[model samples]
Target: METDYAIIGGGVVGLSVAWGLLRRGKSVTVLDGDDGSFRASRGNFGLVWVQSKGMNQPRYAEWSQQSAAIWAEFADELGDATGHPVPLEQKGGYDFHFSEETLQARIEDYETLKAKIGGNYPYEVLGHNALRKEEPHIGPKVVGAILHHQDGHANPLKLLTALAADVRRMGGQVIVGKIVIEVSKPDSFRITCADSTTYGANKVVLSAGLGASKLGPAMGFKAPIRPQRGQVLITEKLPKLINRPSLIARQVDEGGIQIGATNEEVGHDDRVTQPGLSGLAAEAISAYPALARAQLVRSWGALRILSPDGLPIYQESADMPGAYLVTCHSGITLAAAHARLLPDWLEGTGAAPDLEVFSETRFAVS
Candidate 1:
């Protein structure tokens, strides 16, 4: 029973791609690991953000912009299919700055990136007074914010759920708890799981997130991926305090103020620490003083799948031409592009996106 495509990870990245391929009438099978696997999809900050991204690479920025452009329609379609609304708020989002120096520096970098994109970057710098007008609860400690018009957030859990349901609804097979242990190309691609179950497909997509580091080399991928821990915290449902989502926090549709994400290089340990949660709490409080009184509801830590350059890696195996590797840190941000546009590239339709810059060849020794 060979399928058209066998996806090796059922996380956001893999499910998004599977959803796209299924829409094109392709036969697909999603092989997911057990509950014990470290899953970033379920533990993300839920931001469909674009600001502060691709500072060093404008192409990546443009790609993110492209995804943001089509996100609304994508969400709508997923909702319609799954009957589960993927709550999305794209009114705008912010990058709050506590000091003038960091704000100025980031604006300078954005200016350079904006120029590279022929001025496609749409952002506005708001002073304390102006920001206060937008966010009345904003604390005095926060100096300003950069509101990027294309930035926003969504219910990441809902997005994942809708995608999974839609994939199955569209006749795609989803096999859970199938931790793939080996991938070999004898004739067609054979993906062997730990339970001795085997599946065959015409092509393979390795989107196993952090697990790619282990499976990539066997399939001719550099797979130079590492894990970076990000600790996050959430507050009890409260009145609307945040008008827009930011790296610091956002008021979720369900009423909780989702504060997050301290970037730490603490290896693969996704455990919340006192210092990490404390730092996040202090920062959130600094941005919104009202949060000091908000009841802390939950705290968690998740590992971000990061490439060496922190950009997405989209490459085909040199030894096994039909095998492809697709992984990125911005799975939520790029979900639209993955589901709406990436299938063309995977099918080699000639209308495929020019993703050569993201190829593994970039990491080759000079």
Candidate 2:
């Protein structure tokens, strides 16, 4: 079948873009891989964060801020469309530091980034007493925290479900298990699938997450993307422990303490390592000594697609004028931008947000 835009991935990033395109009166199709595809949504920490982002590149921080600023409205629209209200909290999040020296150091870095980004970075350093007042369950080992006003968490499953349901309700096609094997554009783009199926579209978007590492180079994109494995631990539903999310942990809407995320450069191996889990548990217990007594319920690992610099790659193919590469490490944080703002850039409209900094040109070949 023919469409206006054929998206190569059906994950949150692709679905978010597809949802946006359909909202603008474009026909869209999402070609999703088989069940084994590494979906970042599965193990996301559900953080809609802004602090500590774009430490080197302020544009990224600006982009994230733009997305976070409009996220609640976006969620509301999706909820009204699909009747699945996404549970999100924007009451600010924390970056807990166990040592005073590290807390001061992080503040300095954030100060530099804040000045570079028009001095709009809103965050406050909370001393131990101030933090305890905010989170009564905080442990003694926790020294302080940086409470960035833009950071928060959400129920990722609900967000993904709402996005997919609303996309279909808007006449967008979400085709699962259609592994694209080849893509070539003679007149319109022709996509060959492993299931011996084919699809055609006027434009193509390579937002297939880790799958882009293989398909991007063929489409004239330097998709220098790699997988970083992150393991997460979930505790039994309990009384409120974490008042806000941090890189370390958060109390999920369902009352479970979600502790996570070891950044391991272990290639494509997404298996949970005992040592990784142990380290995470130790740090989490230190952050909230109460967590040491909570019973563990579930644990998992997911892969994060990262460019060399960890910024997003938003590049239109030079050879194929209508083909685009869209990838990022912070998919949940940027979902609003992908859905609400990015379509303007794709359409080359007057309202397109400037995304020149995220181009592949930033990566020089060795």
Candidate with top lDDT is 1
lDDT of 2 by residue, 1-366 (tens): 699999999888999999999999999999998888888976789999998999999999999999999999999999999999998899999999989999999999999999998899999999999999999988898999999999988889999999999999999999999888899999999999998999999999999999998899889999999999999999999987778899999999999999999998999899998999999999999888888899999999999999999999999999888999999988899999999999999999999999999999999676
For model 1, residues 30-105, the per-residue Cα lDDT tens digits are 9999999999999999998889888888889989999999999999999988899999999889999989999999
Q: Which stretches of candidate 1 lie over 4 Å from their true place?
A: none
Specify the poorest-scoring 10-residue window by lDDT in model 1: 350-359
TM-score of 2: 0.99
lDDT of 2: 0.93
- Would you estimate the TM-scores of all the predictions? 0.99, 0.99
Residue pairs that clash (backbone atoms under 3 angstroms), model 2? none
